[model samples]
Target: MVSTALQDLFGGKAAEAVLLALFHHGEAYGRSIARDFAVSLDSVQRQLDRFERSGTLVCKRQGRTLVYTWNSKSRLASRLRDLTGVVYDGLDPQTKEQLFAERRQPRAKDKPVIRR
Candidate 1:
C-alpha cells in the first residue's frame, strides 16, 4: 500500500496526489490524476483550483482537457519540485510502484514511435 506520509504532510490526500502527480509527470489534469491515484475527481479538482489560486500552479487548455502544471514563474516553483522529489525518494518501493503505474497518451498522426 502507498504510504500516508505524503497525505499527512500535505494535509489531505488530494493535495498530496496533485503535487506528486505533477512532480512525476510534469503536467496533470483532474481526471487523469484522480484515476491514477484513486483520489476522487472532485477532491483533485478542488485542490487544483486551490493551488492555481495560490499561484503554486497554472492551468491551460489542451484540446478539451484543462491541464495543470507547476507555475514555473512562481518564486517557489523550484523549491516545491525539490520538496516533491524528496518526498518521492522517501517512499517505499511498493508504494512507488503503485503510484507510478503507466498511463500513456496517444501519439500524434504520423508521429514516430520510440521503442525502448
Candidate 2:
C-alpha cells in the first residue's frame, strides 16, 4: 500500500512539469499552463483537477479566467517553494550575503538645497 501511494505521488511526469511551470511563475490560467507544456486544454485541466483534488494546487477566478497556483497550505508545495528559495540563494552567494548583511539600505530623508 505504501509503495503504491509513493508511486502515485511521484509517477506523474505531467504533474511535475505543471508544478515547475507554476513555481517559476506565481499564477497562470489554464490556457497559459497548457501552452507551457504544449498540451491541449483538456489534458492540462485534467492534471490540474487531480492536483486540486490532492490539495497541491488551488484555483481562483479572475474575470473570465480561472487562475491556478500552488497551494501554500500543502506541505509538498511549501517544500517546493523553500527549495526554490535555497536554489536562488545558492545561485548568487554574494547577492544573498549582501542582502542579509543589510536588510534594506536607508537613504537620507532630508532634501538638500541645490545651488546654481
Candidate 2 lDDT over 1-116, as tens digits, reads 01222225547545544654465556766777666545577867788788788887899999988888889889987886566444443434443332233212254565321111
- Which 10-residue window of candidate 1 scores lowest in summed lDDT? 107-116
Candidate whose TM-score is highest: 1
All models: lDDT? 0.82, 0.57
Candidate 2 clashing pairs, residues 3+ apart or interchain: none
Off by over 4 Å in 1: 105-116
Alpha-carbon RMSD to native, per candidate: 4.7, 12.8
Q: Per-residue lDDT of 15-111 in model 1, one digit per residue for the tens?
A: 8899888887799999988998898999999999998998989999999999999998998877878888888777766666677656456767755
TM-score of 1: 0.82
